[model samples]
Target chain A: MNALALGLRRARFETAVYFRQGDTVFFTFLFPVVMLTIFSVAFSSAGNFGTKPDGSGGITAAAFYLPGMIAAGILLSGVQNLAVDIAVERGDGTLKRLAGTPLPVLSYFVGKFLQVLATSALQIVLLLLVARIAFQVALPADASKWLTFVWVYLLGITTSAVLGIALSRVPRTGKSATAVIVPMVLVLQFISGVYLSFSQLPSWLQSFASVFPLKWLAQGMRSVFLPSTFETLEPGGSWDAAGTAAVLGVWLVVGVVAARLTFRWIRKDS
Target chain B: MSETEHVSVRDLRKTYGAFDAVDGISFDIGRGETFALLGPNGAGKSTTIEILEGYRDRTSGDVTVLGQDPGRAGRDWRGRIGMVLQSSGESGNVGVRELIAHFATFYPNPRDVDETIAAVGLTEKAGTRIRALSGGQRRRVDVALGVIGRPELLFLDEPTTGFDPEARHEFWSLIRLLKREGTTILLTTHYLDEAAQLGDRAGVVVGGRLVALGPVDEIGGQDSRIPVVRWVDAAGQREQRTTEPTALVAELHRSTGGEVRSLEVIRPSLEDVYLDLVAKHDSTATPTGVLA
Candidate 1:
């Protein structure tokens, strides 16, 4: 079989295993949804974000936080989950077994990419449904907004997955994989505006976050889910679509290069 | 190279800094032959196997597996060989059948998934998660995956390390079945009996060198396998190493002119000969730092 065909077969197997595990489902797929719920409920009585500059309407805390949750979901599904998963696989001999096989290294990564894409899609759908039903958050109705969401999501997920593959070698052993990766991801979540408004963060913090992909992902998601009137609240006083695309595009290139350099089917010292 | 040679290695050496993990080893495995590599811990068995499997590169050697240098072999070369590692059930979250089926796609010609599972005696556990299975069952899953590719050559690295007696016997039968189908096997095992039962020929490695290589029963030579005639009489304990133990015992009985007390014949088994070989090698060689 060709690499693509073999990869898709592996992807099917990975997707099944990914969804069946209780820890993976709770941590990767549902963590963002649960956190979003808690944040929306905790701040529900605080009222909406003032009024729209264009006199359009009011946006509740839940509505404002939906895009952040979606962005965070993408990060968790791609980066945090994969970094830990690949490290565990490497330490447990999964990569060694595959290395002994005829499967191409590119095919193995293809399997991972497709698995992340499938799980992330499902996770985002679940998050969206929960936000819509429980918090009554409005869904984006414009086709253009959905198109923006798709592109940003594709770029953000590609960057996260590749970076995750590269970062898998950071942990020396499987037991410490979550310990090493979780803290890094959590720090990125806080600094990238997943848990706080980007404009409300200090200018220095915003500048620091701007160097990473999560910040651009969250900003792009905001542009998709939030109204145009909310654009004035951004640090640049507008939704910089081109800026988000450029930053994400650069990170994607960086991630691909890093993954190519660092990814190994077997440990070198072994 | 012989037309029947499945694997050929000459002067194979793997060096880590100044230490030679595998120092000047040479061997050939014929097609459809089961060759067992026996060694104590850190005796370079794993290093040699890894070099042959292409998982590790040798610092110096001429090596070939299935007519190609394993260090430079491509995916097509990989497809012709299979390996069952020391550990088992890596994809624990996946079902047995599913994982086996997934691996089957990597080979140009793969065995039927269910048939392979059955061959390993895992038919009943096909739907079970590998992690949920017992250690022996998980090992069977490992064997299932190894044979699913229908490999021309299979590497079994301590394949029965944790098996119970019954499971080991069953695994031996499974290996015999694969052998019957003409799979050239390279097996490394600590169990002397396992090697004796399955190997057509055996090689003993010590301190990164091949100390003995021959047919399994003849590894230590005629001197080592000689039967010992032991008896008790007026001369307090007596023993003699002899090829004709029956005649020696009769002569002793006639000389004593009565029933000999505590009379018995001892035939040296492979384990005894192996321990003797290792001890002799250990005493003669100068001490070196741990190589593992």
Candidate 2:
């Protein structure tokens, strides 16, 4: 009847399909949990979690990796998943059929965005649970800290998702989608401090990491979970909440604009 | 826009770079009528259909579907029409009923999902995943979604392109059911028999022009085309093309003392006339800009 109702129906269908696909569920939701568990068990063997350096507590491996894995999970789902799906749909002629239908194109995007949000939300929660129970990782204290995590996570994932939607036009066929999307995601993951420590890298590397939102998003999450004393390990020796929001905010705006310009319902060769 | 006319096009033209895809064509489809636009590949059939479906912009033309210009039509107008594109619609291992029900919400008034599935002969496959189905079965899914909206008008672009004879017959019946329910249909196909079977009226589009448009049986000057009479003569066998086969047969009957062996008369089939028209147009090809 209404666009919202129809869009919601489509979204539920999309999410159901997402869950049914084994690989997608494994990569988007389960992989991070598995990684967090492995890292937590490996690093906490010394049994010094929340009781090192500072008399209060020290950062554990799970605490360090939970944020990075969360960030990576978000990136994988929002960027790789969304973009690859779009490209594959294009190759399969799904988009062309959609263009012919009475359904508004905006409704289709709304469905996909909803799917992204649901999967990403599920991922963050699972990572949080595993980190807390298995590794004794710290949770955000005070309302402001929790508030910071919420906005940063939401904005950062959404920005990546929007960029994914825009970049779907780059690949001509479903087979080509991975070729187009994987390299960029791999570059972002390596340079954004998702796999390695930002402070341990050279100054040029840190500067390079700061240019992207994944770095800030992971840093923002670390700020929430880690004690204030651990801020010295960050790029500017402290959490830059304002900078994180501004950079991600710019990416969201630019992504929306690019999606408007780049989105295509029919491929040229077709 | 006449009340009886569901679609009206005046000099519909579409251009791609320097070439005219849909050069200059004009045709009308009455309300509740099944009109088949038959053409070969690259005959601009798809381009014309796309413009009518509101999926593409035309270079220049006057066209209307359901009394609305498709180029400027909105969701309200779209709600009144259904489309079965050349490509598959459903995706990702979804069951038949689930996919149909999802599409139904996009329309204001929709047919019951079960009824729609049954109408397309997919009742047994309701719970079957789309990807697991055969090509023809998947095509039924396409037809299922197209008619699920209970659209006033339906556009089917090569709907039975890859169908086997049996599946095509089944699809034809489905279309007939829709026609009985008073849904206007505009389908494009390369199969002459398919056009003759399903189309009440047929339009032959060649080089993007409506060369011949009339009832399927009478298309391509059917009445005027001469019939050939063949019979066993004193000289073994003879055949003659004539406007008056009856007279020739009568003479032969009398001369042979009513022993007209192997005598038969046959008029040109639709395929013959269509081939003739296409060949004629192909040889005398002119720039599309010049209206024929």
Candidate 3:
């Protein structure tokens, strides 16, 4: 089979396994939505960021949390999921078996990339639906805003997935994959404006988080969902679309290079 | 090497720093022949097999599989070879048939998934998750996946380690079926009877070297195959190793001029010769390499 067909086949295989595991389903896909629901309920009466034109209510906690959750969802399904999954594959000898087969290395990555895309798409949709119907959060109102969302989403996930593949080598064994990966992902979520407002974080922390992609991803996502007036709340008092693009773009290249250097079908010491 | 040889290894050596895992071992396996590599736990069998499978890089050596250097072989080369690792924790969440069918697509031509499952006696558990199966059943799944690609050459690395006696018999029959289909197989096993039953030829590895290589019946040479004549008579207990055990026994009976006490002829089995070979090698203080 050609590379495309083989890659799609592998994607289907990975998706099947991903959905079957209850832990992955809950932690990677459903966790963000669940967190969104809890935050919306907990801060329902806190206040509003801005008021809708209809003046019924302003941007509720769900609206503010929506884009952040979407960004976090991208990271969870992309970097965290792939890192843990690939580490498990290596530990369990799946990579060794595939290495022995006619399967191309490019096709294997294609499978992982596509699986992340599919799962991330589902996660984003679920988060959007919950925010829209359950919590009355508004989506992007124009095609231009959506176009921005599209590029950001693609670049963010591609970078995250590559970094995850690169990070798979860090854990010595599959059983310790989550212990090694979750803490790093969680720390990024906190400082990257996923769990808090970027403008509210200390400038030092913002600068530290700026070096990573999650902060920029969340910022780019806010540009899509939030009204233009809300850009003033950003760290730079604007969305800085060029900055987000540049940072994520550089990380994408870096991630691909790192993955190439670190990825192994089997462990080195073995 | 001849054109019929599927695998050729010349002076293959794999070293980890100061220790040599496989030290200057050389052997060749012909097409459609079942060659067993018999050894103790740390006897460099897995290292040699991994080198042939292209799973590990050798420190220095010449090794080829399917007419290509496995170290530099491409996907096309990998497609012709199927590997069942010593212990594979694969297919934990996937169904037996599903994983088999998925792997089948990786080859140019693959066997029918259901047929391959049946060959491994996993038809009943085809829909069951691989992790849900018993140890032996899971091993059958490993075999199923290995053969699903219709490989020309198969590597069975201690394939039946966790099998029950009945499952081992079933596995042996499956191997026989594959051999009948003209698949060249390189098998590594600690089970001497398994090697004797399935192997056309066997190589006895000891101390990171190919100590003996020949047909199963002929391995360990004439000295190893010598029969023992034992008799408890006037000398109390006496045992002698000789090629002519029948003549020795007749002489004992005639010299006694009566019925001999505890007189018996003991022939050495493959296991006996293998044990003797390993023991002999161990006693020589050859500085055996430590296996991983």
Candidate 4:
């Protein structure tokens, strides 16, 4: 059989396994929903801190935080999930065994890439459903708004998946993978508007957050899920769709190249 | 380059800096023959096997597996080879059947997944998640995955390391069954008994060199070593290592008037020969610093 067919088969098998695992499902699917629910409910009745400017007459914190929460879901599934899994597999000899097989290395990764996409897709959908039901946030219904979501999510998953895979090579061993990744994810979450608005963070912090794809992802997602009047809450006081695309696009290319350059079939042991 | 030789290496050397891990070894594995590379821990047996498996490169040598230089061999070459690693199966949650069947897709022609599972004696646990299975059962899954591709050459690296005695026996038979079906196997094992039982020919490596290579039992010409005859003497003591024990026994028989008490003949076992060779080699060679 051809490698593409086998890769898809492998992808199906792997995705099924990922879905069956309680921890994987919890992290990739349920955790995002839970966090979104808590954030939506906690900020629902709370007074506005930034004199928020969404044109819905009153500040709907859920609507404001909806896009960032989805971005968080995307980050967990695409970046943290893939990075941790690859690191653990590296230490356990799975990658080495797979390398020794007749399977093409690219096919094996393509299989994993599919799993990341599946999990991230499920995460985004679930978070959206929670926001719509509990917070009364509207879905992006029009074709053009849906189109924005398409490019943003596609670029988001592609960049983060490759970035996750590239970063998997950094940890010395599987046991330390969490130690290496957790801090980065948390810092990005704080700065990239996952929990607060980009404009709410200090000015110096805002500049730092703009360098990463997470900030652009959250910003791009807000463009899809929020009203155009909400752009004043952003850093530049406008919805910079091209800026989002440019930063994420550059990261997408850099991540692919970085993954190719840094990936190792065998674990690096001192 | 002979028609019957499936794998061959000449003057193979692997060096990490000034330290030689595999030093100038040459050997041949005949088609469909089970060849065992036997050595104690860190004897460079794994290094040699990895070079043949195309997972490692030799610093300087000519090597070939299935008539292709393994260092430059491509995917088509890989389809013809199979390997079971020392440790694996730290995999995602999946049943035995699923993982084995999935691996079969890599090869152009693969054996029936069910048959492979049955051969490895995992028919009962086919649907059980691998992490829930016992360590030995997980190993059987590894073997099933390895051989499902119907590889022309199978590499088993310390395959039975942690298996219980019964499980080891079953695994041995599974390998025996594969060999009977004309699979050329090259395995590395520290267990001398495993090599003796499964290998038509065994090579003993020590300190990065092939010290002995021949039929399993006759390694180091143990069979040709003299046997010692022991019997009660006027001194009531014993001495061995007699070159002419049979005639010596006759001479002593005449002296003792055929009343040979506590009479026995002692011959060196393969283990004795192996230990002797290793001890001698260790004493002579400078210790290479640990690489692993």
Candidate 5:
């Protein structure tokens, strides 16, 4: 068979295998739903949670945390999935076997890219469904807002997935993969406005967050679901679609190059 | 380019850091021959094989497989060679038949998947997931995968290492069957008996060099050194090492004026010559500072 056909076949087989694993399916699809449920319930009553800015009124916690939940889904699909899967495949010598075949290195990455895209699409649909049905959140009414969400989410996921593949090359063993991913996940979540609004953070922290794709992604995502007036709270009183796209595009290029240069198909021990 | 030489290597060298894994070795395997590379662990057999397989780049060497330099050969060249690596960690979710069918697509011409499976004695387990197969049965699957392309040259690296005695015999028979089909086979094994049984000619590798290469029986070719004669003597038993076994036996018969009891002549086995050759190679190379 041609390389592209073989690559797609292998990639489909890999995706099927991932779905069969009970724990993977739970973590990839079910975990987000569970977290969204708990967060929605805890934040149901407007005045019961954290107070609003200026202490004049209490912001509805559900409104404040919905964006974080969506960002978390992106992280799960992009970073966590790619990192752990590549590391495990390397540990098991599957990559080594593929390296010897006629299948080129780019084909493997293409397969992974397609898998991540499909999974991310599924994650976004599920999150939107849960928000509308369970929490009574309003759906995007305008075509432009929905288009913004789709592009931002796709660019965000593609950047993170490629970064994860690049980063996974550093860990030689599967056990070390978890150790590397956990700390990175925690740090990125903190800086990305997943736990708090970037506008509420200190100026220095805001500037630092601006350097990463995560903060821009979360901001871009929030711009879609939140009111157009919320744009006033942004660094500029506008949605910097071009800026967000640039940051993600740069990261994508860097990630693809680094993965090509550093990735090792065979085990160091072997 | 000799007509007899099906495989050839000249000044093959591979280095990792400051160490020479394969330090300038050369050898040849004749057409329709089963050649065995015999060595201990860390003796550079694997390095040499990896270079030959084009899985690893060599530091410097002139090497050819099927008359093409593996390093620069295209897909068609690779299709002509089949390698059963020391370990293959392919996914186990697919049934054996499905897996073999998938690999068969890589070649321009492939053997019938079912017939190949049957040749490896895995017909009963064709539908079984590879993960569920026992170690021996899994090894048979590996063999089946390696030969699926009906390659002109097959490289079997420690192919029967984990096999039971019965399974090993079956594997040997399969290899012999391949030889009958005019496929040149190159194998590396730690098992001496396997080499003795399968190799038409065996080469002993030591300290990154080939110490001896010839037909299994004539490796050392020290036939005149002495044969050990053992038999029942006047008291109980006697043994003697002598260069002239026929004269000794004749003298013993004349002295006894009758048939010799329990007469037996023992010659050196391939294992004995192999160990001795490796030891001599080791001692000679050490003083000059050779490294494996």
Candidate 6:
């Protein structure tokens, strides 16, 4: 009956519903594992593709791609999945029906946030497992480093989910939702170092990527996983935890405020 | 507010830019009574219900549902009221039981989920996914969700809008069952038959105002309206409208030598009265203030 109790109950129901959705499960959990396995095996023998200062390849291809793949996993659960689902619900009038209930509108968002967190956690763990055993990439054995990875991963997922919620309000129909989400996600992945290292990308692309939070989140996540000696490969050859947190914090605030402003309980045309 | 009055509204006004959706309408619904807000499309019926449901804020007015102002009422007030919205599209993955049970947790005292499902005639589909159900069955699920908490006041907004005849009858029975359990119902529907059958008293809303309000039989003051007498005569058929139907019948009998063939006295039905009221209201209503 209390707000907290109601929120928790709704969150449990929402998570159950999400898990039952076959496509959501595939994209959130199975798709990342499948992609990780295929990519790691296919590029096993080749070294990492980013260029060294001496015009030679740097790390192994699997090592360079591990972070990118992890970033992709975060994208699948946090942005693509949440955006599409929210859009479909809005289009179908489910959100309006929920709004009519005694349940607070905030409870619905809490449920969605928790669902994304759980799915993203499962996804990150699966990605790391495949990276460790199949790709033979070494994970951080230090407790402090693992703690940093958890914190950065949580912050990234939270920021991306809020951003997804904000973006979903723009698309009024399900078809338009897909159209908007596909291009937006592809553009972010390209510019955010999910597909290639920032240094290897064109100069303009690297500078453009600086405007978004994804690039910083991926870079911060990699800093936690890679060795201290590999700091030079980072954006500024340093682990900028404070900067990453600041950018993510700003994005989180903006995303929530925008969502609150734009979110429609009932379709305007309807 | 009195103990007998379940809902009360005074000077209720809702404006959209330069237009008024519901302009200064006032009414009250008594406890355990079936009250109908009858109107055609765009008649501000939905707007009034939304304001009562706390889904929208009125531009200006005093409105109360179950003795509390919906705009300022918190969760406890909401729990005491049930609302069946115009449409619902629950997620495809959740089964009926799962969804119902989940909603039940929001209330301090909720009916048994299985019993609620049975009450809505959805027991057979309890384990089925919401997406797999047909429109009518899904509507039953919506009703089940609405009443699972056993609300003291229930708002049904065009509850049978998409139902087939048989489904509508079944839903009517379900509503009657709720009434039997002493739940107050506030219904809005375009179907005059639904209003006539379910409502003890109906209010005709026009041009953002309450044009008429009374029992179904007396709506439009039709009982006092001039009664029309019809009969088959040598000139094909004859008709006359008069307040004194007994005198007219006696005069007709005297003219026909006490054997008037196919003589029939006709009184206006609720639909006829409703149409006449709306027509009269429209002609007199300000062009800008039409409720719909």
RMSD per candidate (Å) reads: 3.2, 4.0, 3.4, 3.8, 4.7, 4.1
Tens digit of lDDT per residue, candidate 2, span A62-109?
A: 887777788888888898889888888878877877766678887898
Stretches > 4 Å off in candidate 1: A52-56, A266-270, B89-91, B284-292
Interface RMSD of 5: 3.6
Output the number of the lDDT-best candidate.
Answer: 3
What ranges in model 3 sit over 4 Å off?
A50-57, A266-270, B234-236, B251-263, B284-292
lDDT of 1 at B151: 91
True contacts kept of 3: 0.70
Better of 1 and 5 by DockQ: 1
- After superposition, which runs of candidate 5 have C-alpha atoms over 4 Å from their true positions? A46-67, A264-270, B1-6, B91-95, B222-227, B231-264, B284-292
Superior by lDDT: candidate 4 or candidate 5: 4
* lDDT, candidates in the order shown: 0.87, 0.82, 0.88, 0.82, 0.77, 0.80
lDDT of 4: 0.82
Tell me how each candidate scores on DockQ against the true complex.
0.66, 0.51, 0.64, 0.59, 0.32, 0.49
* Fraction of native A-B contacts kept, per candidate: 0.63, 0.51, 0.70, 0.68, 0.24, 0.56
DockQ of 2: 0.51
Candidate scoring better on TM-score of 3 and 6? 3
The candidate that wins on TM-score is 1
Clash pairs (backbone) in predicted model 5: none
Answer with 4 or 5, whichever has the higher TM-score.
Answer: 4
lDDT of 1: 0.87
User: Which docking class does model 1 fall in?
Assistant: medium
As a whole number from 0 to 100, the lDDT of residue B144 in candidate 1 is: 81
> Candidate 6, which segments miss by more than 4 Å at Cα?
A27-31, A45-60, A227-229, A260-270, B222-227, B242-265, B283-292
Q: Docking category for candidate 4?
A: medium
Predicted candidate 1 versus true structure: per-residue lDDT over A1-270, tens digit per residue? 999998898888888889888887898889989988999999899978646566557888888888998999899999988999999998888888889899998788889999999999999998888889999999989999999999999988988898888889899998799899999999999999889888899999999999988888998999998888788888788778898999988988888888778887754453
Pairwise lDDT winner, candidates 2 and 6:
2
Expressed as tens digits, the lDDT of each residue in A1-270 for candidate 6 is 666667777778877788787866885557767766776677766656555678664555566667776777777777887788899888776887776667887777877888888888877788888777777777778999878877778888888898888888777686678777867877887788876667678777877887788888878777876666667766677878887889888998998898888877543321
Clashing pairs in 2: none
Superposed Cα deviation of residue A222, candidate 6 (Å): 1.8
